[model samples]
Target chain A: MPYRYLEDIATADVAFEAWGKDLGELFAEAADATTNVMVEGLASIKRKETIDIELRNPELDILLYNFLNELVYLKDARRLLLRAYDITVEKEWPDFRLKAKVSGEAIDHARHRLKADVKAVTLHRLSVRETPEGWKATVVLDI
Target chain B: MRAQLAVPESIKKISDTVWEIPASYKPGMLVPARIYATEKLLKEMDAGVFDQVTNVACLPGIVNYALCMPDGHWGYGFPIGGVAAFDAERGVISPGGIGFDINCGMRLVLTNLTYEEVKPRLHELVDSLFYRIPTGVGSTGFIKLSFSEFEELVEQGSRWCLKKGLAWPEDLELTEERGCFAGADASKVSRKAVERGFDQVGTLGSGNHYCEIQVARPENIFDGNTARAFGFTVPDQVAVMFHCGSRGFGHQVATDYLQVFLDVMERKYGIKTLDRELACAPFNSPEGQAYFAAMKCAVNMAFANRQVILHRIREVFSNVFKKSPEALGMSMAYDVTHNTAKLEDHTINGRRTRLLVHRKGSTRAFGPGMEGIPERYRETGQPVIIGGSMETGSYLMAGLSTGAGAFYSTAHGSGRTMSRHQAKRTYRGEKLKRDMEARGIYVRSDTWGGLAEEAGAAYKNIDEVVEATELAGLSKRVVRLLPIGNIKG
Candidate 1:
């Protein structure tokens, strides 16, 4: 697992920590963790559609939030059950940009077992820090 | 000076129902932090509630104490069950104060049918409801609106539902603000927010959101006059209650503003908050006003959302019992919003002033004399719908005169005692379903994992929370609602 659900948080929402050898992988893992929160068995999600997401923020943390929030928007707006397949993060000083390619299809209630509808990505105690291992981000999804 | 963000330990017991953390406990705090909970509840209260409430007290121009209701639980920025008011001229408005599910509220409907009358066919009724009322994640309503129509819905609130012939005229009368709040500017709402919300107006969003068919317990009615006022005339009278809000529309609006406020709050407005999630701008500033206008659109959208759901439910009942809506005597009891910010006049420090009151996971229990309540309920007071877990039961309550102490607010529900992950680990969803079935409660949910996360053990005892609210004179019980059928989203 590239990300792990954290139990230290409160009951009102879900918390998880994503890790990677770099920012790109960290973001990809984070996206997967978010999608996993809503439904399990990502392997069963046939790639009926591909969605391209791009986000720009001067700060890495805010950019991360926008990225995740964008996923939530796509899920609700297009009714897609998504799983991030690939991500690339480019950051230089005050600029952070991310482009992610995710694959999924319209939600089939008969197929996909919906777990929790993530309302949004909350910045409450949102954390994105660097360590020797590469990059780690702690986030919460307001479900 | 560095800000203190830790759980305060300097709290002083004010009464059995009140505790105060003085402003002196935190250097930047403009006011104290007061919690309306029993000693027992406080003993087990999450430390995050104390920290968040104190953070709220430190906000600029906060009036009096930042209060947390009896159901207070740890949440982002503002604790769930938190209530605070900011000055129009000086204070700021935080999106976090209302949370992402804007206008997340509850509305109860009363039916002439009694428990005994519906018991034999309860299975059929539940099945029909499950089939008729759209629920679960990705669920959509039958009614689809064009962009122009969507804009109209946002601007008109519940009135739009009535105009579309989806809601009864009596429904608006029993709603907060008569089902319409002023200052709704759909133009101010972002296109993305509007787009996201357009299709989700009637969906029951997931995570603790549900529509329940409950039977009124005759013995649970504490006030006959109030119970009669609410249309709960006899024991076992059935009621329909639902909890939801503006889906992705509200989320997008809140997300858009939180980013907007973050970029310019300190540099442009000189506003400072303890948490980034508490990002806010002065209430009078352009950014704040824009957010307020957009927030109003979200509020109206949520009201319309529930109104449409009520229409669908009425349709289902009509088909099942073979009675017209009027003949069934299906009337709304009252609709109450748990998350919102409204500018209202309140006497603060002797003078009456307009303050923007923000309540998150809290219910407004306006006393009998308040102007905001409906005429039929004017003498009894506002209906405070306290939703309980499907395993336990829910409550219908009425405001009391003395409830002004907590700014006319009470607990929203039995707050979470265990985390979702913990609950899932502790109980099996299938087992829970079987257990509830054995008790005659029919629960239909999309996923067993979802059901596991919302098991009864995950929440604090509803009875305790209601007892605290009543003992503190925040609200009095009208009747307890035992869930006969529940549709979990």
Candidate 2:
């Protein structure tokens, strides 16, 4: 997994940090981290459905925030647990945009072993920066 | 202590139960971060509270001080239990401060039956409650409203419930905002929020959301007059308490606005904050007003949600006991929200100003004589309902005059001392359930994994937390109710 849990951020909320050689892997792994928080049985979710996510912002950090929050919205609004993979971030300067292809299936209460429901992706201490090695994002999920 | 949470050494002690982090602690802070906690409680607090509270103090036009109740814990933008009043003219409004669970609150309903009367039937009642009230993740509610009806509910709040015969007129009087928040704009609500809310009117969302049956202990009643006024008549009198919010409707509303504020804060309004989660626009600005209008819809949705649940509880009790709800004395005591931002007039420097008070993980503890409080409670003040862990007991208290000093807010609950991940690692849900059963407390929940995370040990002792609130003079303890039955989401 390219993403790992951050143990010390909060006592009630969950936190994680994801890194990749490029934005694609970074955002995808972040989604995985988010998905894993609510369901440990991520492997059981067959990708029978695909979702196209598009978001726009002038800032790289805000764009990352929106991308993660969109997944949370989908889970609550559409009853879908989406995982992003085909992710691309265009940092065309004064404007940053994200277009991603994500897949997951409808929530199955019997099949999907549920954990805490991630209410939303919060921007508190949310970090999206380009490191010398790659790109890194820090996320805190409100449960 | 973990390095991630360390209260800075510069915090100055103001009293035995008060501490202040002066603005000098941070360069741009407009006021100090005031904390109501004993030295020991402060030591047990996560150091992250220091940063979050100070960050709140830095918000533009924040008045007085950014205060945290004794039950303060680390949260996204505001330290949970955070209370801040912003000038309506220049201060900013951040959804982060109100929390994603908009108007998440506590509703206490008093019943004529005693603990002994309900103890034997506890298991059956819990089973019925669990079956009747949809809960857990993706728990679809039974009430399905058309979009137009849903829009009406959003705008009318508990009043809609009254019309549906789900609530009494008296019920509205006991609720904050009289069960209906003004300024809700259905047009401003997103369709996604409406869709999520459609079937979620009577649901209990997962993670700390629950419906518990409790009995007031006569010995625990500190103020008999106040307790009677709030409907607690005798020891062992049963009361139903549920902690829930606007469900996914509020979640989407908050999610949508957080993005809007992030874009508008810097680009259009020139506002700056330490964290993106603290994104906000000036309270009077177009974007801010729009968010507030939409937020009111969610607030009303939550009020209606609880009212509908209250109706379900009444039905369950009436069926189980073979009595009408009124004959069972199943009238509501009071309802108060922990997460909300509302426009209210408070005396500032002896002058009343309409300030937008944002309370997160904190309950409004309005003192006596506040017109916003229910008429029956106006003389005694608002009832501040604080929930405890399943094994531990909950509390009922009255907002004291001293509460006005802290923006009339008090601790919401026993703050978490350990993370859910930490508790799940050490606790087993089935084993905990057995343990609770051994102690005479019945536990019914959707999943063991979820139950494991809510282990009582994961939180600070509620007795100590409630004591802190009382001793801090923020609120006065009235009675303590021990849990006999619980239905968790």
Top model by DockQ, which number? 1
lDDT string, candidate 2, A1-143, tens digits: 68888767868878899998998888888889998887876798889899898888887777887787778777877788878878898877778878999999888988988777788878777888889999999988888
TM-score of chain B of each: 0.97, 0.98
Taking every candidate in turn, the Cα RMSD to the unseen true structure, in Å, is 2.5, 1.9
For residues B193-296, what per-residue lDDT tens digits would candidate 1 score against the true structure?
A: 87777887778888999898999877877788889989988778998899988888988999999989998899998888889989989998999999999999
TM-score for candidate 1, please give it. Answer: 0.97
Q: A1-143, model 1: which lDDT tens digit per residue?
A: 68999887857689999999999999888888998898887777889999898878888988888888888888878888887777899976578888889889998888887788888999977888899999999999999
Please give the range of 10 consecutive residues that has the lowest summed lDDT in model 1 chain B: B1-10
TM-scores for every candidate against the unseen true structure: 0.97, 0.96
Per-candidate DockQ versus the true complex?
Answer: 0.79, 0.64
Most accurate candidate by TM-score: 1
Error of 2 at B373 (Å): 1.4
Q: Find the 10 residues in a row with the least total lDDT in model 2 chain B.
A: B1-10
Model 1: residue A16 alpha-carbon error in angstroms: 0.4
